[model samples]
Target: MHGTALSGWLLVAVCTATGAYCLLRLRSDCARARSSAGGEAVMGFGMAAMAVPAAFAEPPSWLLAGYAGVFAAAALRAGWLARARENGGGHHLHHVIGSLAMVYMALAMSAPGGHTAHEGHPGAAGGVPLVTGALLVYYVGYVLTTGARLLPAAVTPRGGGTLAWRARPELTLACRLSMGIAMLAMLLAL
Candidate 1:
């Protein structure tokens, strides 16, 4: 969701591309990579759908409710995965937060007197301003941290050949950073 149609379309494209790349990451041999990629794929596609310009199609209330329900379930699943004694539990924990934020945003949009009128203004949605602000802060910090992690580093590449890019950790980090920035934009629109 954005003020302008062009920005909305851009967001959708970014998210869709990120989702497609994450789907490619599913071929990774590492279980943790596959699992995290699965969750990220869902988030990417979901964000794309939600970012559709209201001018083209204003989703019905029931659909918004469905979004809330689906993301809630995803949040629960992520919470469970986060508790497991796995090396990538941190990634699952981040997914939990991201899913819950999506749920919150969907609910906010579905609520009466929500973003129906002020489609692009911050705090226009029906959620508590503090909560929205908190999510915005979290996503901003996530974007910054992920972006920093993407800085040039001296290290041997793990994967090789034509298919190697699909499993590159740097690519995954870049994908996460893009999504984090998109999330920030969505929250600001809210």
Candidate 2:
């Protein structure tokens, strides 16, 4: 019921900063994955960019514009990369899903008064808040799965365990943790 301007701006700032950090961390990981897996880093950057404007701007229109633009660009870029894959690899599916979820959350958040046909209806969807919650779930899952994939790569791998516990895991953890925090912010907005 409360939609304070300060809170809204704060939400945008937090999400943007965290998302930017994640993208930087992902850049390093993508460099390492380049020889083996080419596009995940770029795709991750695309996802990070999608959330940036939403996180920094107040009101849905400005945020949504950035969100829509980034999402569209990502979809196109992803499609082009997919076409070039010998194995038709879709490694960036996590980024794709995460980005889509962020855009969804942005849309719902930007909705006027958080009101829609579903608002206050018993059997209705509970409007924007419900959609935001669903998006949070998807974002969380995407972060978890991507984290799991990065974990093994980061481990030093000695006798089926990590050793030295090098930089990759640290960077990967940074990316995943930032993403988790961003998603939590979205949840708070609801």
Candidate 3:
């Protein structure tokens, strides 16, 4: 496999793992799981479409339009949710930006003329660079900040059954880190 395909497959793997885990976690915590299930599904499906090999090639135009429409709708819904709740925090902002980044990626893949699919082509013109750059910066910062948050020692639990990191969701953090890496890979592929 070439570099592009390899990156795409790796991204798919990350997203698939995230989506599956999110679904499983949903059984345990309905409210928290409800918020992320749709996003995770989109991530998995989008990455899978991107990762499909040439031997079983699907048209880029189709994939691009589908992903663009899905993510655009998702962004709009997220915006309305934010507005209804008197707005939210970085989580809401990240969802909006992430959806936009996917939309940008889809459009970049669907550039007019005879340009080939994948990044590093003339297809990546227009707003692709700016959007991809912003996403890369944001994900990188998130990973770093999250890592920093993990560094400070929490008060040690006294009881034998106590969990020190009760508030932190390790699985979700792992998924976020994987997504961050996937975002970096996608931008680099560009």
Candidate 4:
């Protein structure tokens, strides 16, 4: 593969690995709480929504269709969680926003005239600007919100003093930063 292609695959690999870590962490939390697997599953699905595009960079038409299906499912789950009376465990709104960002990346990859599409062409001036701007905003929001939630969790003690370090806080921050950088890279690539 060419350098660009290699870089693309690397991006996919990073995203999928991080997403997997997040899924496992949530699963462990579920196990600890003795709760149903529903919440963990939903979060896993959201992370999977992100991994789909990354894992299938030059996917066949059917693969893209599958990506669309997963994204739809993720969106439904996010909406349901949003309407819940009390959000719990993870940061519901922030995850929803991050999920939406993944949706944007997937859509951008599949959209007509996008760089990755078969019949791709340069987008209209305004179109590229609008989409890229929105994506940047989305990642920034993801970073800020996830960071805010993580600060306390990483610092607060469970019984009396905080743990040395918290995985969720660290991972959440890393994900946010990487996503923001990825968004910038995408904009520059455009």
- Output the number of the lDDT-best candidate: 1
Candidate number with the higher TM-score (2 or 4): 4
Q: Highest TM-score among the candidates is held by which one?
A: 1
For all predictions, the C-alpha RMSD in Å is 2.6, 6.5, 4.4, 5.5
Which residue window of length 10 is worst by lDDT in model 4?
31-40
Residue pairs of candidate 1 with colliding backbone atoms = none
The segments of candidate 3 whose C-alpha lies over 4 angstroms from its true place after superposition are 53-58, 84-89, 113-127, 150-168
Candidate 3 clashes between residue pairs 3 or more apart in a chain or in different chains: none
Better of 1 and 4 by TM-score: 1
Q: What does candidate 1's lDDT look like per residue over 1-190, in tens digits?
A: 5468898899999999999999999999989899889889999999999999988998898999999888898898888888885748898989999999999888888876565656565445647888888988888889989988898644346464344767687789999999999998888776
Model 4 off-target regions past 4 Å?
1-3, 29-57, 88-90, 116-121, 124-128, 145-156, 160-168, 176-190
Tell me the deviation in Å of residue 134 in model 2.
Answer: 3.6
**TM-score for predicted model 4 compared with the true structure:** 0.61
- Give the range of the ten consecutive residues with the poorest summed lDDT in model 3: 160-169
What are the TM-scores, per candidate, against the unseen true structure? 0.91, 0.52, 0.74, 0.61
Please give the range of 10 consecutive residues that has the lowest summed lDDT in model 1. 154-163
Looking at model 2, which ten-residue stretch has the lowest summed lDDT? Answer: 34-43
Local accuracy of candidate 3 as per-residue lDDT tens digits, 108-158: 656663234446654433345666677789878977876665455453445
Q: Candidate 1, after superposition: displacement of residue 138 in Å?
A: 0.9
The candidate with the higher lDDT, 2 or 3, is: 3
